[model samples]
Target chain A: MDFSQIIPSLPSLWDGMKLTLQLLLLAVAGGIALGTVLALARMSNSALLSGFAKAYVNYFRSIPLLLVITWFYLAVPMILNWITGEFVAVGAFTSCLVAFVMFEAAYYCEIVRAGIQSISKGQINAAYAVGMTYSQAMRLIILPQAFRKMTPLLLQQTIILFQDTSLVYAVGLIDFLNAARARGDIMGQSHEFLIFAGAVYFVISFGASSLVKRLQKRLAV
Target chain B: MNYNWDWNIFFKSTGIGSEIYLDWFVSGLGWTIAVALMAWIIALLLGSVLGVMRTLPGKVLPAIATAYVELFRNVPLLVQLFMWYFVVPDYLPEPLQIWFKQDLNPATSAYISVVVCLALFTAARVCEQVRTGIQALPRGQSAAALAVGFSIGQTYRHVLLPQAFRIIIPPLTSEFLNIFKNSSVASLIGLMELLAQTKQTAEFSANIFEAFTLATVIYFVLNMSLMTLMSLVEKKVRIPGMMGGAK
Candidate 1:
């Protein structure tokens, strides 16, 4: 409805764009790695590691992202203070990264577990017959194939992570939504700017979705 | 800066020093479940009807279905909440707000807001569900209803909706849980639900960890229970020979 107002705001949007990319990449990289470990832990022979993974995934997955961000933002500082005599140099970027990584870990764990579960027992038997250890076989043979197959899902997860990065605003991060709100405050127009912000989010999401689509189709041969 | 652990303060705050709203927390869980149940019913009935509408012969009906889905699904829930609680009342004449203020409990406003938001959002997904169910129904069932002199409405009421609901049970369960989580957002507009109680307890105790740990544990139990109950229901709904509604 207000095309004229939204058009000029692209430069300001670039700042948000950079922040979004930074948060998305950092969290997805870190989160996916943690998630892989958690998935393996959950599936491990050791009951302790498996139980710990189960609790972590169950706890993180069940809570709303907003509440998680709030708790981490507040609790981290106090926990730090309790540990040390004084405050640490932890910052907003660090805060956002910690919360997103933990939350996304739960989802990625599920996805990675699904990938692992899909691998046939026959393949593992074959590896075992060749005298390969479980860890060696998983790392050398099974995981590489699974990771390749799980790429589209990983991409989709990245998009969701990008969308969820906006929740960092609850913790006072100047992410895209926060920036848009800042502009809206100066311009005195909340609805239009909110729509603009939503559109920006949609663009990032849709782009990733389409890329995933193409990848899925390409892999179908 | 590595520091010493203060288990003393943590335990003192979480335990004896301040009151946690256990009664409020339990009642809040009840209220959350209640709102989710009522909203799920509304979503099921409304969504099924609209879903049926999208499949009916009229071009206009499908368009109406699309419009409903798009409008409700596109906006953020927070904006929708603000509009319902803050904007809608102002549009009504001052006398109406005065009447509502006098007569309706503040909690009713919160409930009404959750229902409207939940129904509107869930209906979109429900419409998709019903449409899939209808399309999946065997071709002769509707014809049999028609040949028996059952009106279109009668056909849907007896023959169609039941079958459709059965087909969509699994997805519908998740939708119920989805609405349950979404209800926590109602605390934003002062609904004192679980999360609201969490915030209130946090502020009162000055120990955020104690308050939030309690909240997280409660949420974990409630949600895990929901998953358990839903699986039981799913098992019960399985018509003995027909597993996962296979043809």
Candidate 2:
């Protein structure tokens, strides 16, 4: 209930929020990029490419994000060491980011696939009739429409990604939640700090989701 | 850099056949299922009520339901779990607080907190799904029930809910699977669930890959089976020439 304790700790919390935002933005960007490719692969004619993408999406989607973060946290350094001839240190931040990107990509792939499939096949046939190559048709025609149709779902998923950034605490990454917990522990006002942090998360996510709803309405028109 | 891999550690007893690392995993799996099942009961019951309230013919109830969904759905489960585990107990009456802190078993208390936290968190999502399912029903469905002398409650109970449940099987299945995955967050509050047990085994044996790989495979199996089971249920309950059926 007391805002006074949390006010004095805003500076440290902001530092954690920056890392949290960094992870969220980077993961979302990487996830969407990879997800688009995976979606296309899933739709492709080749068995091997589609099979690999399906397996990747299924394996990632089936597990807990916490476990994925832990796995990458523990395994990435070893993988890096094997790749290079030196002992490489993948920090918790990097490992967490990698895990988020990899894990979220699976969900995003499904969204992107649904978006692409929503576009009428006649449009693609028309593009081919106009002497457009497959890649050109997809780039200039299909992807643009698919991306537009999927913007709201994409934003909704981003809201989910924002909430899940708190899971980085599992790997000892001091995200916004952990930062608040640390300040609370120091001040013996764990309740107040936690309540404040929860409110902050609510406001941001609720705001973002409403924006998505608005965008969805506008797109409907 | 001596990274030892001991896959056999899973079979080795902790001490004189008391238990093995694999036993920890099995117990953890049991707790995970128990938590998920209990939370699922809370979610279905509460979510249905909230969903009905949102669709009712009043402004106040729907507003309250909307607020509840927005509040619970927006916050991360980890933060909510922390609040329930660490903060909620403080708000209890002095006698109850004393009993909670002094008399109750710590593990049982942790388990209850996790189940409650996860249930409320997921109930918000289920509320949305239920709302959508109800809204998707044809107006004539309810109108016919009213014409047949059914009250509004009877209309919803007999005419709407059955069809809504049928319509929402797929999403509900996904939500059910999600709760199972989300149960992993309970490990943060020191519940020795599957993920926590995997972490324990990994740290103890220093074979992180072996331990986590086993955990991942177990999770994958659980999720895939749920997916298959739900799909079968979907097929069984699917309205003829609707939803999943080809016209």
Candidate 3:
């Protein structure tokens, strides 16, 4: 509705989007890696490892992401200081990154677990027959297939992560949504700017989802 | 910053003997449950109707349902919360707007807006689960009901819906948990829900660790119990040899 406000504010919004993207990319990479380890741990023969991973995933999954962000933003620095005997300032970005990575890892762990489970047990055994260790077998044989099957799902979760990065606004981070809000308040067009931001969010998410749907279809074939 | 841990501060009064910090968490939990339950009802009712619409015999009905899902589902809950808070009040009729803005208690008004926002957002997701449930049913069941001279509504009520609902309980459970978790976003709009209370206590006591750790444990307990309850219900309602009800 207010094209005038949105045009000049594009740069500001882009800067915000860059931060959002940075959060997204970092979390996805770190989360998936952590998630894969958690998944493997959950599937491992050792009850201790499996139990720890299960607890981590369950605890993270049960709590709200917003709470996790708040907790980490506040508590991480405190814990760091307690350990080091000096006050440490963990910025909003790092705290949010840590929260997202940890939180999203649980969801990603489930996805990766399901993907790995879908692969036949025989395949892993066969890899073992060739004298590969568990990690080596998983890396050389299972992971490639699981990653392929899980790609669309991982992307879907990434879309969710993209949308969720907005919550960084809670801890005083200037993510895209907050940036738009800032610009909007400055220009006395908060309503229009918010509407525009919402539309932008809808388009990107909808577009990404459709792409996932397409990928699903292609993978099906 | 030498911070002394005060685990007992939750039970102690906040220097005035008016209320313990834990009282804030209790009330916040109460509001959280109220908001989540009310929103869950709306999600179930509206979601089922929209889901039914999506699966109906008409083209327009499905189209409308599709649009509703796309519009609501794609937007982040936080943005939607903001819209409901700031934008929707402006669009209301003048008297209603006044009631929302002036006549109603600030907390009550915020509660109402949050419930509506959360319900609508969740309904979109629930709609998908319900649709999948209905479509997952055997086509012959609906046809059989119709052949027995049952109206479409009767067919759905007696034949299709009962089974579809049973099939969807697991997903619906997750949706229920989601509503509880998502209720945290209401704090952004100044509703003193659980997360908000935890933040407030952390700030007041400087025992951020104890406060959030306690909140996390409570959330875990709530969610785990819900999961256990739903699993029991699923087991009870499980129609043997059915798609989702299989043990």
lDDT order, best first, reads 3, 2, 1
True contacts recovered per prediction: 0.23, 0.79, 0.75
Clashes of each: 4, 0, 0
- lDDT by residue for model 2 (A1-221), tens: 56678888999999999999999999999999999999999999999999999999999988999999988998899888877858987799999989999999999999999999999999999999999999999999999999999999999999999999999889889999999999998988889999999999999999999989998999999
Pitting candidate 1 against candidate 2, the one with the higher lDDT is 2
lDDT tens digits by residue: candidate 1, A1-221: 34465667767867876887898888998999999999999999999999999999988877777677777877777767778868777777887788889989999998999888888988888889999998999998888878888888988777757766776665667787777777766676655676677665655566667778899999876
Residue B79 lDDT in candidate 1: 48
Q: After best superposition, candidate 1 residue B203: deviation in angstroms?
A: 2.5
Docking class of 1: acceptable
Off by over 4 Å in 1: A1-8, A210-221, B1-20, B23-35, B50-114, B128-161, B244-247
The share of true interface contacts that also appear in candidate 2 amounts to: 0.79
The Cα local distance difference test for each model comes to 0.76, 0.92, 0.92
TM-score, every prediction: 0.79, 0.97, 0.97
Q: Determine which window of 10 residues in candidate 2 chain B has minimal summed lDDT.
A: B238-247
For candidate 1, lDDT tens digit of each residue in B1-247? 4333332432443353473356556667777777778888888889988899988987999999977865655444554554566546655788888766567899887778777777777888888888888888988999999999999999989998777777877777767767877777677667877777666666655656766777788777777888899878776666655644434
DockQ values of all predictions: 0.26, 0.77, 0.75
